[model samples]
Target: MLNPSHLHRLFLYGSILLSQVLPLAAQAETPEEIACYNDVQGKVAWNQKGTRTWGEDNARNLCKGVVQRAKRISCFEAGILSHNNWSKAISDCAQTGGEAITAIVPGKQCIYNRGGYALTVQWYNPGLIVFNGGDADDYSKYSTPGTPFRTEKIALGQTSCTDAANRAAVVRIIGQGFLNEGITIAVGTSVGIGTGVLGAIACVGTAGVGCPAAVAGVSVATAGAISAVGLALPEVKEIAYIGVPGSTNYLDFSGTAWNVGISNKVPLSQTRNFAKESAQTVASSIKDFVTGGTPGPRSITFNNQAGYVAEMVVIYQIYKDFGNGTIIPIPVTKSSGQISLGFSKHIDIPVEIANLPISVFINGVGTTKNQILGATVPANFSGNRCFKSFGTIFNPQSSNCN
Candidate 1:
């Protein structure tokens, strides 16, 4: 219905509008893509939904000279200079919507040395720029200063082996990991080895620089030697030595086997040794006195046996009521012996007592039950009073009738 000129003008306007609208509609469909471009300050173009989200070339363009700035800032921070310069650089990075330069990267160091910066800018990404070090294939062989030293365990034995072959074996075992290598050996003061012996033992094969010519058999002396050895072998950072106890002579070969790289000492207890004796003896005089019979000389025979010769003392206590209501403890007898182990000996212990209600207590080696050898004294002595004796390791029995 419109005129030709009006129609032509309308067509031209519609074409221009279509061109602008189509591009805007495509951008509107990918909001993240728009944000990525805006966030990286137009330096990086990103296709958020694509497999390659960011172009490496774009990242390189963004980080062109940032690595050099990061290195200079880091070195300044470590030095005695005022921290304001370093702080300003970090602030600038943050203001640019990039990560703050906190540490000097290894790649940055290489770039600085080569007088150029070839770092990829991941400012919009999560991490710092990393330039390849070119020696990646040999990285495994690089030992950092933080690497820990190796450890080895060695055991020293008891007993002195005077024989050359035996001494060699002992040395071989003691120097398990450090035979050709320089090492420190800590010896206890209790060790009987002399200074000459210790030096001769330590200084073998490749003697380390400043190795002690002699080491006194003392902990302090060994420590001094260790310091000297450490100075000699600069590669060997630290050496730990453990002293073993109960090592007698060079050949006694008795000690715990070393499993771990550290030392463990175990305590040994003393062995047990003791002796005992036992016997039964009739006390006719006391029995006769209790039964109101004629008193006669009462002979007592003790069947004693000893085991494990050890010095020991025996104690005997007799309680009696001598025609009085008050019962009194009487010192009957005391004996001591250097008793032989597993041997039986006969002994005679005679006692003369004039009492009705009586009780005898005997303790041997100062240890045993029924060391209270006799039965309890009767509450009231009306019939004959007699007892059978017994003995044990703690208590020994003797014959006594009085």
Candidate 2:
């Protein structure tokens, strides 16, 4: 017979093996692992692989949330404050237009598109048919778990999210859309989408029949709310915005949204979005807010420069990065709305954060014909944050990145 000590030893070994095997699901989401998942939300592209290993991922991923399509009627005015003293020591700040009051005013329809999915219907209402779509992975779909689906819905600015209107269903929820998944189409609506990607040009009746901006499998979003939260992270990893540090990683892009910036040889916008949503604020992610639903822009004339821009917004404020995804927005200073921008008038917006470096965000809108002719901006590498050390150089307590 085996001695008692030998038996005890065997039992211990067996127990260790069981512990490792049994808690696979539990350990898969340990405090460290959960932290890693949350880290990648703002730093990694939603479509790209988030983690190769928990440690490698955790050590690397950092920052807040994502950016979105027009997401707001995100006009030039919105990027600035209606009033501000423009001082790092001063906390005076306020949003312009929709940012001033998103509760219900200046209605902007937004539509999001899910790239991969089996089938799903976000909402079924005929009242508001303005189209909009966005990528959704965290939400549970019947056939797929983490795979994102192209979803469509009417935004909250409407009479009511659940309220109905006599309008026809502009966005369709057919069983199969471009990728054979659920789809939303906003027909004649406008505003609340910035990126130039979209599925079909929005027409009157049908979705695919006619759709709208944000290049197809469109990506461009925003948050109606803004919070001057600090990035509160370390600079352990070379400070990446959406991906890594590089001029090409400009910011505010999803799916192939980078393509528009590439083909034009310009950076993306200076805008960054909230990667997720919170009870206190509304983010760009569709899962956080089920509500939705436009596309417009054409021609080009920056300060009378037929081909390029001449002026820019020197003031800037670092807004919160929710959970949707990251993006590039036009550069601006604390004293924003300083530039009176009109469609086709070229302007420039530059920024310098925390004495790190200077980045630029170009501005200009075009006619309704040349949909992708507006100005572009790149991510503020100077503002690329990754750690959360309290009051450290990497952690400024306010929107004062500079």
Candidate 3:
């Protein structure tokens, strides 16, 4: 309908408007501004110095790049960031300092960290799976059944290996996940298995599994069978370490064998050496406790028959919850429509009159808004001096006679 020259001018004007609007729209969708999106919505975040968000299609493409080539990968390939950001936020956690990042994808680090061990289980789908330290406390066990393979980053700590600081960092990253499964956590050892929930905290063992704090020399498996229904929180925050409180001459080796009698008589130096060995065990438990993870070194006991009584020093830390100033009020109902109070309203009236003769009573009590304040009374009851006594009976300004 217009001349060619006019049409060209209109196209230029439209282009200018689009160029200005597009960037503004993009800015509004920054990572911080983006709301939680669903699986279908396909939103992903990358926290490198700061948060970077991408929509579904773009997020998927970027996730694939990072998972395969990027220095770090977010937990959600295309989902709500709030729902899953533990691992993604710290996948390259080691690079971010000593802090370890927990990934929902169990043993993901182990898979990449332990290149020698072949990965057998496929974690492409979501479910419960053991990430590391399958049936034993050895990283090598990752190559064995019941153990999910992991690379260097995912491998559990090596016993007696001294990397206290790094181990502490990594332990913190996985503490919550391990505790939910009732799996013992330590720098050298970690276990993850299907627990029926994404962030389940307690563990339910298979039937017939049992563990003795100290198994007599015998080659058999032992585990405490706990239910998975609601095992989600570790009851205690930390465990105190008492130096291997057990008999010096009595020794149990992984329920596999026990050497008793004449062989038990080790020189005093060897006895001290054994306690030194336990120091690492104690260290591991302490790390778990300080990091809010389950205690390592499950149990220790002594044989009464043996004349060995060792006094291992114990170390324990108390648990406490410092208030953060968040208060919830309690609400309460009353028997009578009108609540009443009983007190000597007159300052002139002896305080003893109200304190002895009448007692203040409240009927219904419940929280209103994190605070509790409620009372009820019968309409037929006589009004107390505090309510009815006027100027002659009491003066609010008077000081207590007592």
Best-matching candidate per lDDT:
1
Q: Using Cα atoms with residue i matched to residue i, what is each candidate's TM-score against the true structure?
A: 0.16, 0.17, 0.19
Model 2, span 1-402: residue lDDT tens: 999999999999999999988875354333322433454434433222332233443222221011211221122212223332122101111122112111211212222221111112132111111223332110111111011112343221111111211111122222322221222212321222222222111112222222232222332122322221212112212111111111221211111111111111213332323222111121112111110111112111222111111232333334434547853433344211212111122223234323223333233333222221222233343322211001111111111111
RMSD in order of candidates: 29.3, 28.1, 26.7
Model 3 per-residue lDDT tens digits across residues 1-402 = 899999999999999999998885565331211212232132334433234544454443332212111112222332224534534443422232111122232321111111111111122111111122234222121111111112122221111111111111112122222222332223322232211123211122232233111221121112421112211112121111101101222111110001100111322123232223322322222211111122222211111110011111111122234569643322221111221111111111112111122222211222122111222222223422111100100110111112
Each candidate's lDDT (Cα)? 0.26, 0.23, 0.22
Q: For candidate 3, which ten residues in a row score worst on lDDT? A: 253-262
Better of 2 and 3 by lDDT: 2
Instruction: Tell me how candidate 2 scores on lDDT.
Output: 0.23
